[model samples]
Target chain A: MKTQNIPKATIKRLAVYIQVLTGLKRDGVEVISSEKLARACSVNPSQIRKDLAYFGEFGVRGVGYYVHELISSIKQSLGVDRVWGCALVGVGNLGRALLRHKEFALRGFSIRAAFDCDPYKIGEVVSGLEVVCTRQFKARVEELGLEIGIITTPPERAQRAANYLVDGGIKGIVNFAQARIDVPKNVPVEYVDFTHHFYSVAFNISSME
Target chain B: MKTQNIPKATIKRLAVYIQVLTGLKRDGVEVISSEKLARACSVNPSQIRKDLAYFGEFGVRGVGYYVHELISSIKQSLGVDRVWGCALVGVGNLGRALLRHKEFALRGFSIRAAFDCDPYKIGEVVSGLEVVCTRQFKARVEELGLEIGIITTPPERAQRAANYLVDGGIKGIVNFAQARIDVPKNVPVEYVDFTHHFYSVAFNISSME
Candidate 1:
């Protein structure tokens, strides 16, 4: 499959679909119609069918989709069928929360190593992963064969962290820091900005008034 | 402004622009051109102009935008010009991290109250806010006049937390739990699913390989 041709929005919905399907599979839901799946995901039924059609037909014409089968297919398409080792930089409260986040492991991503520059935090063990110096980031990431880097450092240190991650041969980055760090075009970076959601919610609430 | 007519993507972009503008303002950037702002935001200059046009004309054709003025205009349009009091349910690690997050307060949203069903955490104070019992949710929210509810509870408890928030008269919700929660149509809910980012990065990396 040439993923480059797939719409970014479709990829996002595919991820959401996988999350919904995983939950349904856990609850013993074997089959789900497009309407039911759409309702679960807060999307239009036709939109779900359209998004799924991008990859290939995964649903029966009239019956529906098998939850387990759909999950496997989507996971395979998203390349999350196997574990991807990841390195986490900055061991502050947010980073610590992410370290203990079970969803990442459930989704086949592992935070194998942690890095920090603070002397007090450098030797500490967090969520069972020892905090290593940021100066050793490139070497440690290479040693652990980590593919992705998660940046949770303060805004001021985010760029430096990204530089280290890039130097460490990270293929992708999930940045939680508020800073916008520059990276090569080859490395895909996803920003998890909490304020975005807050602003949306605030706007919606204020609009109601 | 009847925000209803604005594109959702525009609203999201506006949030991103605010983040970038805030950083620039902190660094004492007084004015920025459309092209320069677009480069900083990783967006097209025309797209920025279009999004801002939805609200009003803020940028000078030749002189560019005054950083401070643009931030104020966007914030006012997004209804984040004033502080929004919010209640956070589920004082777990993720919830605690959110409480310590400075971005929310920086962007005019305050987590004024925290709630948990756990007896051990009920009386605990996290990030200076005392964790209250879920049983007291409605009363505390009413007393504090919190307009937004942030759910960081475990998946199983998310719906209950949302229900409590809704019953407490919350106008909006930000759900971090890996569950698709049900809320009234009038109440908006945003999902902060970390797995979505992981899946996208995993797919992009796989495509590269």
Candidate 2:
């Protein structure tokens, strides 16, 4: 398939589609039309086709897309098939919570080392992941060839943490920190600010009420 | 204006519009055309017009949308003008981190109570918000007239926490717990499971890498 600059929205939807397909495969379903996929994703049918079309002719003319085949394609396409080591900085409450999660394990990425400056939490294990000293982030990351990191540090310290991760040679970052981090041009940053999402949620409820 | 059943996709974009408008307003932009708004939002011009037209005619045939007025209308449509007193269940690390955030304050929702069964944390003021006993949820909620809640409890206790919140008169809930809570048809529940969003994020990163 020819390379296309797929919109970030489209890429995000691709992940959602992969998830739905994975679910369908688990449920013993095989083929799925754009209409069914759109409904399940709470998106328009035209959107599903447009998004899937970006990757090439994954869908047949009449019979719809194959579930298991698409999952493999998406997994390979997303580069998730290879083990991507990650470091979780700031083993705070949210960081600790994420360390316990199985999603990272399934996707071939795990927080093998969680770094923190908090002396009290250092050397302790959070969800079986070691809480390493932040000072060792560069050396440990180099040793493991870690590719991604998560920043859950305080907003004031988030940028410093990001710089630390970037210097450690990580390319992708998922920042839960409020203050946006400055990553070099090559790094792809995804800000998962719960406050932003929560604002909309609270705003919606209040508006409805 | 007629009360039209705007698509959920359109409703979702309204939130994005508010964000874009807020940014534009901060920059002292006096007026913005649909194309420009779409550019800021990364959506197409036609989609912007269709979305804006749903609420009523905000754009003149030639003058485009009045930046401040459009923002005002969007804010009202998003129900952000009013304050919503929301309780937070489970004052774990993630929950505590959320309590200190100022974004929610600007959005007009305050975490009135943080509930946990841990006796060690009871009576401790987290970010100045009282950490209350789980046993006191219903009474405190009734007294406070809380209508919305955030369930940050672990997966095991998620349902019980959800039930307690709902029974106490919460009409809406933002569940961060991994478990899908069973709710009566009347109650509205939105899950913001980090695992789910993380899966999408990492999956997308892998796809494009």
Error of 2 at A94 (Å): 1.5
Per-candidate TM-scores read 0.98, 0.67
Worst 10 residues of 2 chain B by lDDT: B193-202
Tens-digit per-residue lDDT, B111-207, candidate 1:
8999999999988989999989987988876679799899999999999999988898889999999899999999989888887788888888888
Where in model 1 is the C-alpha error above 4 Å?
Answer: none
lDDT string, candidate 2, A52-125, tens digits: 67666687777888888887776665556567778899877667767776666865677778999989999897
Return the top candidate by DockQ: 1
* Model 2 DockQ (Cα-based): 0.20
**TM-score top scorer:** 1
Q: Model 1, range A1-209, lDDT digits (tens) per residue?
A: 54556777788888889888988999999999999999999999999989877668789978899999999888877788889999999999999999998888888998999999999999999999999999898787667989999999999999999999998789999999988999999999998787888888888877888
- Count the clashes in each prediction: 0, 3
Lowest lDDT 10-mer window, candidate 2 chain A? Answer: A193-202
Instruction: Give each model's whole-structure lDDT.
Output: 0.89, 0.73
